[model samples]
Target: MYNLGGSVYWNRKTFKKWFATRPINLKWMLLVILVFPMFAATWEMKKSSGFSPLQLLGLLVFAFAFMSIISKKTKAPNLFFLFYVFLFLLITNLLLVFFYEGSFSQFGDTIRTILPFLLFFYFRKHLNSVIDIEGFLITFLIASVFPISTLYYEILFNPIREVYNTASRGGGLRLSGFYADLFGYMSHLICGFICYCYFYIKYSKRKSKHFIFSNVGFLFVLLICLIGIYNLRHQASWAVSLILLSMFVYFIRKQVSAFQLFVFFIIALGVGGYFYTQIFETLFAKDIAVYEGGAKETAALNGRVYLWKKYYAFWENFNVLGQWIGAGFAQHEKSSVMMSGGMHNDYVRFFFSTGIIGILCYVSFLIYLIKKTLKTRIVEFKFLLLASVIVILMYSISALPLLASGALMYFVVAIASQINKNIV
Candidate 1:
């Protein structure tokens, strides 16, 4: 404590020293800063074209991350080669922008897409220990509470007008929360649910009463997350959530007693059965009706099938090398002149924008990461990485998870990379 004008206070320098000395504090601070944009959504920012406060905060975090990487004298991990491939892809895209006469919008989009990968390397370089990773995850869980609260608040008191429109149009009200779109909101929830399951499993391994209570609390949070996903009414998100939860249970089944597993199955089945009707209605009925009505009927998948057909036909016009430069947003908008939305499929979008070479590079990078992750001794981290990869791959079939929620994707990758480094 230090005296300031006759008042006692915790000295700023003392606090700074304490924070810097503890690795966990630094990890938590980094994670909170990385996740800050998710919770700082505002109406004015949404309506305006300028950068939001959170984006500015993100830039500051990036600056801090760059400085940290430069100041540290640690050796680079073996996995650093992945960054070379990413940089190559970035350079290829930049070349396309230059050679293809791509607009500023295209250049901007490319930068946004690559920024998260750059940040991931910075995070992997800094968060080196198991305790640091755990602390970062806990900080992520804490940060998640803000968006979850906002989601429920919108559900309870401030339903957007589009909610009524969806109901009127014979569909569910898609929860957008503070996000600009439902997909972004659902992606954030997916990350939160994963963290909750991870912590629940971590605590359940301990036999102490406190750990048991914490496990029960985390279970409650998991249920709450399920409800939140259901409220979003996104079929892909629901499926991914169920898949991740199942993976978690299966992973921990060996650690639990037979009776405990039986009880869990019973609870899951009862809850699932209760929600079966709504789930079926939300996931299948609309699509089934559209299919039965033939070509005259409104296409299901929110016109995704139609958009894919159009984009695929357009893509055929390009040679085997495909469009070297990304088909800028302007081109996408022009292609969707008659339609209301985008291609929705990331593979299609990637092929159209970056061509077959980009796809090969991207797939190779994922395979490399998966191979590395599987070789790690940290079973829990491996399970989390594999589960996240599966969900992200599935999600990419319908939405561009990398382009839309790349930061979260890289956050998961960074954690896995650090875990693997620790093993070596």
Candidate 2:
């Protein structure tokens, strides 16, 4: 019920009909909002530790887009319940940081992740009715070129051209380009791999293009992205990229027979097994410490297990209250547990930083996305969701993608565009 002009209104339908008109076509502003994420590396490169133009743009875009969703232009506003839930959790966690470890820098870092979702409601509000999101989708792929180009250029100056490293990535010295961190580098590489793979699958089904030019172009792009990840020697990214490609094979349904697809998967698994055993296993067979897992040694997994063990010990030592919320995200300033080069795992990061409940909330949000996405009928959306799951799961296992919300952001756009389509 709403109180309008001191008069009580009861019927919801009547209120909406009498309230306001739906807004007209808002051209695809998503292309603009995407720029916020595309510049993440450049933003990091600034290292100003102050307000950045990119951040200012993110705030303005999110606030304006949010206001639009809450206002007259929006369709059934309830369609965005998930986004609201996520936003609430993130904002609340931002406050939690202050209570336990009030570090403005940590606050800034948290907000950077949150800002990616600011325009999510816009996708939820307007995109459901509009079909053929290809134009919009291409922008995301194009945005990847920035990271790919910058990272590749960085490789030129590093004097390391080898594809695989043996020491800390084959000891070949994997560089992060403008991203400046292996985790961040892996995040973008995964994103680019998925983007290129999506196009490869999409264009593969396009019957008109010749096999040579069309397939070769897509293959070149996808292969280049894969090479970047391999060069970085990020094991999880390498693993996820293979899984993502396997899914791509399954999704490219029109052109290939079931038998052919099965052969593809077999080849993929065989290659992956061989690579893991030969390259990854041999390089890191021995470590400072060994753990029990089907596939892990301290060094083979790049000491992620060690870091997670450290975080786990810290969490075990926490008080009951601390266990629930962890000790907050500013561990560098507040915690007695100390380590160098930062924690590689995000789940562990969430646990040690936010606590048990915090990690659940973070995971639950992704589960919600997967659930919602499962109901989407669009094939393209399915690909996006699948690729997202692959990268996010891989990242959570082996790296901190605190700033890698681009996939989730695009996933929102893909899912939101399907809402009206699902309404019958």
Candidate with the greatest lDDT versus the true structure: 1
- Stretches of candidate 1 above 4 Å error? 1-39, 43-46, 58-72, 80-87, 98-104, 160-170, 183-188, 209-218, 271-276, 290-300, 323-342
lDDT by residue for model 1 (319-401), tens? 44444533432233442221111566656655555555655666666787678767866556767667667765777777766
Q: Say which candidate scores most in TM-score.
A: 1
RMSD of each: 7.0, 10.1
Question: In candidate 2, what are the lDDT values of residues 325-420, reduced to their tens digit?
Answer: 555443334342321116656666555555566667767766765677667665655676556655656666756444444443444344433432
What pairs collide in candidate 1?
A: none
lDDT score, candidate 1, position 397: 77
In model 2, the Cα lDDT at residue 75 comes to: 62
